[model samples]
Target: MDIKTAAALHRLRLASIPEALSFPALLIFGTGFRIAFDYDALVMPLGMLHGVLFVIYVVLLLDVWNRTKWPVKRVAFFFLLAILPFGGLYGDKVLKREEAAGVAAAQAREEGTVDA
Candidate 1:
C-alpha cells in the first residue's frame, strides 16, 4: 500500500481505540449511576456519548476494513468487540498487533528484503 493509505489506516486505528474503550466505560458508569444513586438523568447524557462514540467506532472500523482488506469474519469480530464490555481494549490490542506487522512488512519491502 502507498504511504498515504497506510497513514490513513493508522489514524483510523488510533482514533478507534478511545471510542472503543470509552463506550464501555460510559455504559458501566451510566448503569451504576442509575442503579446505585437513582440518577437516571445521567443515563441520557452517557447514552448519547456512547452513541456518538459507537458511531465513530463503526465508521473507523469500516474505513479500516476497506483499507486493510480484512476478511468478513475479522471485520465482524471487531464489530462484535465494539458492543461487548471491555471489548474495545481487546480490539486495541489486536489492532496494535496488526499495525506492528504491517509496519514490519512495509519496512521489509522498503529494504528490498521482500517483494511486493
Candidate 2:
C-alpha cells in the first residue's frame, strides 16, 4: 500500500477503537434504562443517540473494508462484534494489536531491514 493508504488505515484503526467499543455500551445501557426506569422521554433521546452511534459505526466499518480490501467474511465478523455486548472491546484490542504490528513493520522498513 501507498503511504497515504497506510496513513488512512492508521486513522481508521484509531477511530474504530471508540466506535467498536461504544455500540454495545449504548445498546446495553439504552435497553436497560428503558426497562428499569421506564422513562419514555429519556428513552427517545437515548434511542436517538444509539441510532447515531450505529450509523457512525457502519460508516467507519465501510471505510475499513474499502481501505484494506479485507474479505467480506472479516468485515462481517467485525460487524457482528459491534452488536454483541462488550464485543467491541475485542475488536478494539484486535485493532490495537494490528497497529502495533504495523508500527513494527514500518520501523523495520525504515531501518532497511524489511522489503518495501
Clashes of each: 0, 0
| Candidate 2 lDDT tens digits, 10-58 | 6655555565555556556777877899855665676677667667777
Q: State the lDDT at 25 in candidate 2.
A: 61
lDDT for each candidate structure: 0.78, 0.69
Of candidate 1, the 10-residue stretch with the lowest lDDT total is 1-10
Residue-by-residue lDDT tens digits, candidate 1, 25-76: 7878899989999889988888888888888888888887778788999999
TM for every model, in the order presented, reads 0.80, 0.73
Best by TM-score: 1
* Error of model 1, residue 100, in angstroms: 0.6
lDDT: worst 10-residue window of model 2 = 1-10
What shift in Å separates residue 89 of candidate 1 from its native position after superposition? 1.2
